[model samples]
Target: MEKDAFAQQLPVEKYTRNIENKSIFYVIRKEGDLTKPNFIVSYAWGNYRNDLVMTMFGRLMLLMVGLIVISWLPCLGIARYFTRPLVQMERHVGRMAERDWHEPISTSRKDEIGRLAKAIESMRQRLVRQDRAQQFFLQHTSHELKTPVMVIRSYAQSIQDGVYPKGTLNESVGVIMKEGERLRYRRPEIKWEMDLAPHTTLIGDQEQWKIALENMLDNQLRYAKSCIRIVVKSQSLDNENAVKGQTSLSKFCISNDGPLLDQAIADSLFEPFRSGGDGQFGLGLAIVKQIMDHHGMTVRAANQRDGVSFYIEPGKQTDKTSVPKVS
Candidate 1:
C-alpha cells in the first residue's frame, strides 16, 4: 500500500504512517544484497505508545519514591534544627516568668534566634540587678524605720513604768512625741507663693514629676524660715541656625528664705540616704534626682543672695548662671 510505494521509490528504512485513522510504525532492513529480498517489520502504534507511557510512568514513580526516601532523614533533621532552639527558649521564658533568672541563655548561631536569645539574656541580667537593688532598698528602709520605732517603744514603756527616761515626765513624753512624729505623715501647709506661667507645659511623667516636686518642696519647707516661692516660665532659646528659628523651653525655679546649704552638703545633695542640714537621712532628694535623670532633665541647687534656690530645666546645662531669674 502506501508503505510499499514509498519503499520502492525512496528505499524507506523506518517511518510512521496513519492508516484508517490508526497510526502504525514500519521498519525495513536490507538482507544480503541489492538483488536479495529485504526484511520488513511493522507494529501497531497503539502498542508502542502504550508501552512508552507505561515505562515512563513507572520510571517517574520510581524517581519520586527514591527522592522522598533519600530526603526523609534530612527533612527531619532540619525540622529539629529549627524547633530545638524554640523549645529551649520557651522553657527559659517560663522559668523567667517564675522569677528564676539564674541561668543565662546562650546561642552561637548568627541568626534571628541568636539575637532573640541575646536580648532575653540582657533582660534577665537587668531583672536580676533590679531584684537585688529592691532587696537592698527594703533592708535599708526597714533599718531606718526600726530605729524610730524602737525609740518610741522604749520611751513609752518607761513612761508606763512611772519613770522619766529623759529625767522628767514632760521631757520623756516629748522624746516619744518626736520619735512618733518621724513615723507620722503630715499634709503640707501649702503656704508657698506660686508664680506659674499660664498654659505652661513640660514633657515628663506627671506622677513622677509630682513626686519630685513634692520632695523638693518638703525639703524647702523643712528649712525655710517663712517664705517660699515657686516660679514657672517659658524661656526663648536662640537657635545656632537662624533658619531653625527659636525654641521655647520651660524653666522651673523654687526658692526658700532658708539658711544657705553647706558646700559639702550641696555636693552630695542627690546622694541616697544622705543627711541634710537637719541631720535627717532620707531618699526624698535621691528620688527626685533619679526622676529628673530619667526624664533627661537637669536639676541644681544654688545659694542665692538671701536664701537657697533650686532650678529644674531641660538638657545638660548644670551651671546655675545659665538659668534665667524670674523675679
Candidate 2:
C-alpha cells in the first residue's frame, strides 16, 4: 500500500504520515469516481506570499482597511448632524450672556430645543426693555436733580456772602423745600375726591401709571390749598363716528382747586425744564406725558374755574367696571 501511494501518478491523499519535514495540501481526484482508491490527494506546495503572511490572510487585511476608510465619512457626517442643535444653543446662550438682543432667534421649530430657544429669546427681549427703561430713568433723574442742586448751592453761598434777595427769605427757602419734596415720597393732608369707575381697568403698566399719577398729585399738592379731584369716566363715542362694535372711550381726568394755571405756563407745561413761577422744573408733567404716550393715551391741560384740569384719554374700551383690586 505504501509503494502504491508513492507510485500513483494522479493526485492522492490519505492519513498524514507520522514524520517531520513533510507538508499537506488537499485536492480533488480528476476521474470523478468516488468508489476508487486514493480519490482525495495531498501535496506540499512551497509557501508563495511569504513566511510572515499567507495570501488569504493578506487579502482579508486589505478588505478590512478599505471598509474602515469607506465608513469614516458617513460616521463623521452623522456625528455633526446630531450635534448641530447643541452648537446653535451654545451660541445663543453665549450671545445672551453678552446681553446681545439685536439678533432674533428661530421660534418656528416644534421641538424641545425650539421651546428652550423661545423662552430664552423672550427673556432677552424683556431684559432689553428693562435696561432701556432704566437708562431713560437715570438720564431724566440726573437732569432733574442738577438744577435744584445748583440752585441750592448758589443760594447758600449768597446767604454766606451777606447778599440776600429783596423779598422775604421764605420764597428762597420754599425753593429748597420744593426741590426736596420732589425727591421724597410724601402723602400730604388733602381731600381726595375720586369719582373713578368701578372697574377702571386699562391696558398699561400699572406701576408706571402709578408713578405718573403720583407725580401729578405731588405737583398739585405743592400748590393746592384744600382739594384734589380724580375722575375716571367712560365717554361714549358718537354713534356716527363710533367703530362698528366699540362704543365708549376710557378717560381719566385730574383737577385740583389750587389756582388756575397761567396761559403761558400751560402752553409749555409738559415740556421739560419749563417752570410755573415755582421752584419746580416741568419734568413732572413731562414724565406724565411720556407715560400717557407709552400707553397710547392723549392728555390735555385745560383751565378750570378754580384750578387746572388734566384730561387723559386712554384709548380703549373696558370690559366692565368692577371695583379695582387693591393689592
Candidate 3:
C-alpha cells in the first residue's frame, strides 16, 4: 500500500489489515521527525491467535491434571474416615443378629456416629443382661417345680402302697394336699386390714399394679401370722426424698406380723430368686420390684418391732394429690 494510504487507513499503535484474504496485525511508529515519516511493523494475526489459543489450552489442561492429583489422596482419606465407622457398625449389627453379645461395641469419636455407637452398645449390654437373667430364672423355676413334683409323687406312691408317710392316712393325705397347694401356688388366707385414703391417686398400669400387689401380698402372707395391714396415705416429701418440682407424694405401706428378716436377706430381698431361708419360690418380691421400677416408684422392706413392713411410694410426685377427705 502507498504511504499516504497507510496514513489514511492506519492510526498510531496496533492495527489489523487484510491482504490476499489473510489477517495481518501491524504497528506503526515515526522514524525521525514525528510528522515527516512513519514505519510499519507487521505479523500474521491468524498464526499468532492459533499459537496463543494452544498455549492457553495446554496450561489449562496441566492445571486441571495437577488439581486432580493433589485432591485424590484427601478425597480418599475423607471417604474412608466416614465409611470406617459405618463398616464397623454393620459388623456389630450382624453379630447382634446372630445373638453374639459377648463382644462389646466401642467408639471414641464425639460426633453423631459416636452417639449412635454408644446407644447400640447400651442395647447390647441390656440384651446380655436380659439373656443371663432369663437363663437364671429358668434354672430356678425348674428346680422349684421339681421339688413340689417329687413330694407329691412320693406321697401318692406311699398312699398307693397302703403306707402312711406321716404316720396316718389322714396326715399322709394332708401332706399330699399341702404339697398340692405349693404346686398350685396358693397364698395362705389372712385378714386384710386396709386404711386407704378416699380418692387416693396412684397412677400406673392397672394390670401390672395388680400383679405387683398380688405378688407382694403372697410374699407377706407366707411369712405373716394372722393379719396384714395395708395403708395408703399422702405425705409431704422431705428434703432427702424430695424430687425436683415436687411438694407431696402418695405412700403405700403394707405391714405383716412376720418374723424379722436377716440384714443380708433384707438387703437383697428384691433380687430375683432370693429365698428367705424358707422352701419358697422367691420370684414374688422381684416381680414387685420390677413393676415398681417400671412405674418410677420405690419399694423398700424394713424390720419393725414385731413384724416386717413394705413401703411403696412414687419416686416423682404426680400433680394430682391424694388428700384425705375431711369427714
TM-scores, all models, native as reference: 0.55, 0.41, 0.53
Best first by lDDT, ranked:
1, 3, 2
Error of 1 at 102 (Å): 1.2
Using lDDT as the measure, name the better of candidate 1 and candidate 3. 1
Tens digits of per-residue lDDT, candidate 1, 1-327, equal 445633563454666778788788766554545666565555558578889999999999999999999999999999999889989989999999999988999899889988888999899997886666566677877987999989988888898999888999999989988887886445465457889875454445668878998899888877887788999876544434322433344688999988999999899888876667866667888899998887668888999998999988887644333333222
- Model 2: per-residue Cα lDDT over 1-327, one tens digit each: 356454556664343332355443344443445456444454443343254367778889999999999999999998896577668778877987887766777756677867887888788786776566556666777887888788777777776677665345777677767767667645567888989665334545668778888888778777777888988786444446334543343777888887777888788788766656463554688898888777767877888878888888864343232322121
The most accurate candidate by lDDT is 1
Best by TM-score: 1
Q: lDDT of model 1 at residue 29?
A: 53
lDDT of each: 0.77, 0.68, 0.77
TM-score of 3: 0.53
Per-residue alpha-carbon lDDT of candidate 3 for residues 13-125, written as tens digits (9 for 90 to 100): 66677878878776665364446665655555777888999999999999999999999999999999988998998899899999998898888999999999999999999
Least well predicted 10-residue stretch by lDDT in candidate 1 = 318-327
Better of 2 and 3 by lDDT: 3
